[model samples]
Target: MATQYDRIEPPLARFIARQNIFFTATATGDSRINLSPRSTDALRVLDDNRVCYLDLTGSGSETSAHLLADGRMTIMLCSFQGPPMILRLYGRARSLFHGTPEYAERLAASYDGEAPLGARQIVELTADLVQTSCGYAVPLFSHEGERDVLTRWAMGKGAEGLVAYRAEKNAVSLDGLPTGMPA
Candidate 1:
């Protein structure tokens, strides 16, 4: 069975707050659907109908591009260690670049050390529907803290290296759409 809400209720918001990770999905016309496993600590539930996440510099900017073109995005979070449940947020999302005021405001209030090396943009989402279902098939695995490999790599790169890396890998989507990434 599944349940849906026009806005995130107290219990639903609590569940979202307890999760350590979330997944994001997006796509555009004729472009490849992008599903990224972003189990970061940067997501925040803003009130009952909004959520935001800090998207790091990755190899592809599909999410950014798709959001720009279509404004469609879905974020999913599953209980990996506790009860078996899956929460999905369907919404319209907008990507805020680093130099923009919106990005700065949201990033400042998001999390400590969120704007780190290789930081790219913050995705602000206005969720239209919140759904939860029994995740019977979801395998449970205890979290052992976030992996430091990516963090270490980004730290090693420093700010200058990160800028170069973004230029080479994250400037465009797989289908050649501009991701609105800051240069």
Candidate 2:
């Protein structure tokens, strides 16, 4: 069975805080739907109806591009250890790219003025519907730890290299949609 809520309650917020991973889904009417697994301590619940995450440089900027084309997005999380629940937040979102004041403010307020190397943008979502379903079928797996490969890779690339990499790889989605990354 599934339950729905208008906002993230206290318990739900706490549940979100404990999770080590989450997934994002987005797309435009004509574009391929994009789904990606995300980790790192990148997510923040701003309020009962709002959330934000630090967007790092990656091979594809599909989420950003899809949000630019259309604001619809869904964020989902499943418990892999204890509880058997799946949480989904359906909402509209926007990507605030680097060098923008909105991104700066959000980073300072939610991320404590610290963003990981190769940080690309801040994706803020205003969730209108929150749903939870039984995740009994979701296999349980122990969380060993987060990987350091992305941080190491970013360090090796350096700031300039990160910029160039984004221009080359993160500036557009696989479907040729612009991600709004600065040129």
Candidate 3:
């Protein structure tokens, strides 16, 4: 069975926060699909209809490239520790690049006083529909700890180095799509 809403409700927000991992799905009009497992204290609920997350440096920038091409995204969260449930946020998203005015403004408003180290982009999600389904068959897994390797690597690079890393490693998707990463 399935249920849908115009936006995320209070209960859904609570459940999302409890999730240790979430999956992001994206695709262009024609290309390879991308489904990525994301973790960390990166996601934030801006409101019932809006969400945001920090995009860190990675080998492939499929999500950013796909979003830039198609603007559609689906984020899924499933309950692993409690009753069986799966929540999906279907929406359009825009990737804010690092060192841009929009990125700076989002950082100011979203990050408060402290800055996020090696922050590359802030993906702003505007959900058009929220859905929930029975997740009776989803497997359960325990979270160990947040992966610190990315953060440590980014920190070791410093700001300019991180930018160079993005140019070298994150500017293109595996499928050769341009991610529009900062220069």
Q: Highest lDDT: which candidate?
A: 2
Query: Best candidate, TM-score-wise?
Result: 2
lDDT of 3 by residue, 56-82 (tens): 887778998998889999999898888
TM-score of 2: 0.98
Q: Point out where model 1 deviates above 4 Å.
A: 112-114
Give the better candidate number (1 or 3) by lDDT.
3
Q: Model 2 residue 170 lDDT?
A: 90
Candidate 3 segments exceeding 4 Å error? none
The per-residue C-alpha lDDT of model 2 at residue 126 equals 99
Query: What lDDT does the true structure give each of the candidates?
Result: 0.86, 0.93, 0.87
TM-scores for every candidate against the unseen true structure: 0.94, 0.98, 0.94
